[model samples]
Target: MFKVGDHVVYPYHGAGTIQDIEEKDILGEKLNYFVVFFPLNHVTLMLPENRVKTSGLRKIIQPKQIDELATALKPTESSTSKKDAARPYSKENETLLKSGDIMDAAMVISNLTSKEGERTNGLHMEDRKNLDRAKQFIVSELMLVNDLSEEEAYQFITDNSKGA
Candidate 1:
């Protein structure tokens, strides 16, 4: 269980800190909840304490793992053709996003970035949205793990995604 001030990622919602844990009575039953503040997204959530494990609430990746994440963003050869790479609104990509694992998120971003690079018309509407969401996930964790500003984190991901 995470304590106050712990940095954690809440799946598709991106990363945040555990600001507080409160117990409240509802329907005459008391339950504990975790108050998480997502600075990147300007959002807060009160997740049930009992649901943290099942809810995919996990601590942020360690600083050393950043190198591995950068590697994941690097361009790579793939068996699938560009046109079929990460098909519009792909379920596989969606699952990766929902996994709440930083490496999984990196893989999704890498695949989509490669697809975007291969396209002249750009990603379809759904694909574009997925790319944005995947980027946010990476950006959020990057900011926390590296103590970087939002712009810097974004640029870091963009630069690494380009394999530069």
Candidate 2:
């Protein structure tokens, strides 16, 4: 269970602070929940205490792990032909993001992000959505772990993703 004031990555919702833990009656059962508040969106999320693991809630990745992720981002390359099959690749990226492995997530984003002269019309809409999802996951996690603003994180990732 997460204690108050802990920084946590809340999946696609990005990073949030655990403001409080409260017990509420639901269907005659008392349930303990974490009240997480997102500073970016100014929203609150109530997460079931028992479902944290299942829901993919996790602590911020360690600084050493971030270094590993940065190293992984330094060499982002994917065979476009292999990714031609949209659904499978997209699903794979989604899984990578959900895994909460920053390096894998960065690889997925770098794979999907287009360069200055690159073309994207050939890519499927689903693939684009998946790419956005993966980028969001990585950016959000990076922001929280590094204590950076969203814009800073985006710019940093964009700059770092070029040759990765």
Candidate 3:
């Protein structure tokens, strides 16, 4: 369980700080919830305490882990495109996002990036959405953990991956 001031990432919601935990009576039952604040939007989210594990709430990755993830992003080609062929591609992408591994997320983005005139309408839409999700996840974690601004984190990633 996370305490107040802990940084966590909520899948698809970006990174947030746990502000407090409160217990309230609901339907004659006492339930606990964590109040988290999203730094990106100044929005607050109340997540049930018991659901943290199942909901994919996890502490930010350490610096070493981030470095590994950055390295993974530098490789663009996939050995087997069929890894995602058994299931629907969109569903596979959703599962990847939920994994909360920035490297896996970045792989999805890198694999889908298209060259000029190579993207179809459907593939282009999916690529854009997945890329945005990957960027948000990486940027938010980097900004919080490294004490860098979002813009700086973004630029760092872009610069590091420019040769990939």
Clashing pairs counted in every model: 0, 2, 0
TM-score of each: 0.93, 0.80, 0.82
**Tens digits of per-residue lDDT for model 1, 87-162:** 6746778898999888887787788787777778787777777778888998999899999999999898888988
Task: State the C-alpha lDDT per candidate.
Answer: 0.86, 0.72, 0.73
Worst 10 residues of 1 by lDDT: 81-90
Ranking by lDDT: 1, 3, 2
**lDDT, residue 11, candidate 2:** 71
| Residue range 19-117, candidate 3, lDDT tens digits | 999998989989999999988767899998988989888898787776776676663544443333222356566678878766667776555542211
Top candidate, metric TM-score: 1
TM-score between candidate 2 and the true structure? 0.80
Put down candidate 2 lDDT per residue, 1-164, tens digits, no spaces. 68999988877676778999999999999999999987776789999998998998888787668667766665344445534534336777777777766666777766666421144345566667766676666777677778888898777667776662
Q: Clashes in model 1: which pairs?
A: none
